[model samples]
Target chain A: MGLKEYAGKQIEIDDDGFVVNVSDWNEEIAKAIAAENSLTNLNAQHWQVINFMRKKFTEDGDTPSVRALGKLSGVSIKELYELFPKGPAKLAAKIAGVPKPRGCI
Target chain B: MSKEAIERVSIIISKGSLEGVYPGLIMANGARMEGIEANLFFTFFGMDAINKSHYENIKVAAVGNPGLHIPTLLGCIPGMSALITSQMNKTMAKLDIPPIPEFLEMIADSGAGIYACQATVEMFKLKKENFISQLSGIITVGEFYQMAAGGQIVFT
Candidate 1:
């Protein structure tokens, strides 16, 4: 794990740039990461998707795919891209402070 | 930037068998998950994966498949393919892997490009309407090569 400083706090990240410790997460970190990804604002929809992914990761030990996120998060994949740009699943997971999703992330 | 980032991934699915098709599907999904653009081009019998009526029917091939390590005679036994397919589906479901249609929906929803080979489509007497709506287009080999130029290409 690599230590990165953001918002005056240290966070652990994997070689792949995914967060290694979820407990080190906070709103500030999320916002910072999102901004780094070119998402300027975190809206209700983005929050919904983020919270949903965090919850799923906590329960399932794996993140849902974009399809599942679409069906369950009430956010379409196209909209996810609009929100997270190139890799919505990975970028969203990163902002949500979770490990990158395997298949659909 | 060394290789900077992979901008796109082009997957060529050349077989209709589940084992062949799933690899491409899985990889494309993985690529999109990583924030890279993924394009899947189905060629030859691989066209079955995009055929709306037939996509869901793709079955695991247990016969003469060295990957399975089953004895040749055992694989030749009747009902082996069906049994293998059933078992594979069960395992996939246990892992929460989506079915064919759902996988397609996910890939497309992830903004990956899904294309079919024009030569294969014509050879199989298939039309644009015969494929699922997720298909971006029926492209010629020239077009596919053009699409794969300078990007990663996977032949599955």
Candidate 2:
């Protein structure tokens, strides 16, 4: 784990660059993470997914899988790939300050 | 550790059994989840995995299988294969693993290429409509090799 500054706060992040403490998350931090992932624009659709992920983690104690995100996140599977490019679920979870979803799809 | 990562993979699915088809699907899906390019080539009995009428009805091979620990003769009994298949399906469902058709859709949507073998399609006298909608196309082995260039090839 490493400590990094985002939005003027020193936050701890894991080896995968995901925040170690979910409580440390904020909209500014999310935008910083998104920019690091080359997503410079956090548009409405992007916030929808980020909010959905954070809400699910708060309610379920775990991040949703790509399949779950596709089915319930108001984002289609093809569009999820378009939004996150490489790995949608993992990247979104990282930006959303949640643990990566486990298991193979 | 080697600095080079696997950028792409071409998986060959040649077995028709339920066990045979899932490994390739899982691998292809896993690759996409990791941002790796993946391709699936369905040939021989494996065509059943992509075949519209057969994809959903794939059964476990109960006979001549030592993994079940049941007598081979017992496996030959009527309804044994179906029983095992249903039980396996239940276990898979509990694990959140989708059935074949849905799995194919997921893999396809994940940006992996799903292709059918031209030779097998011809041998079975099948058309494009015989396979699932997720199929990228029917391709020859030569074309598969062309696509597999610069990538690893795995036979499942």
Q: Against the true chain A, what TM-score does chain A of candidate 2 give? A: 0.96
Candidate 1 local lDDT, B21-131, one digit each (tens): 998999898887777788999999888999988998998778869998898889888899889998999999877788888889878877888999988887889899999
lDDT of 1: 0.85
lDDT of 2 by residue, B1-156 (tens): 878989999999999999999999998888887778999999999999999899999999999788989999999999999999999999999887889999999989889999999998999999998888889999999999999999999998
Reference contacts recovered by each candidate, as fractions? Answer: 0.72, 0.69
Off by over 4 Å in 1: A12-20, A60-68, A102-105, B1-3
- Sliding window of 10 residues with minimal summed lDDT for model 1 chain B: B1-10
DockQ of candidate 2 (2 decimals): 0.77
Best by DockQ: 2
Interface RMSD of each: 2.4, 0.9
True-contact fraction in model 1 equals 0.72
Q: List the residue pairs that clash in candidate 1.
A: A87-B35, A105-B33
Encode model 1's per-residue lDDT on A47-87: one tens digit a residue: 98899999888888887777678778888877887777667
Each prediction's TM-score versus the true structure? 0.89, 0.96
Tell me each candidate's RMSD, in Å, in order: 2.3, 1.2
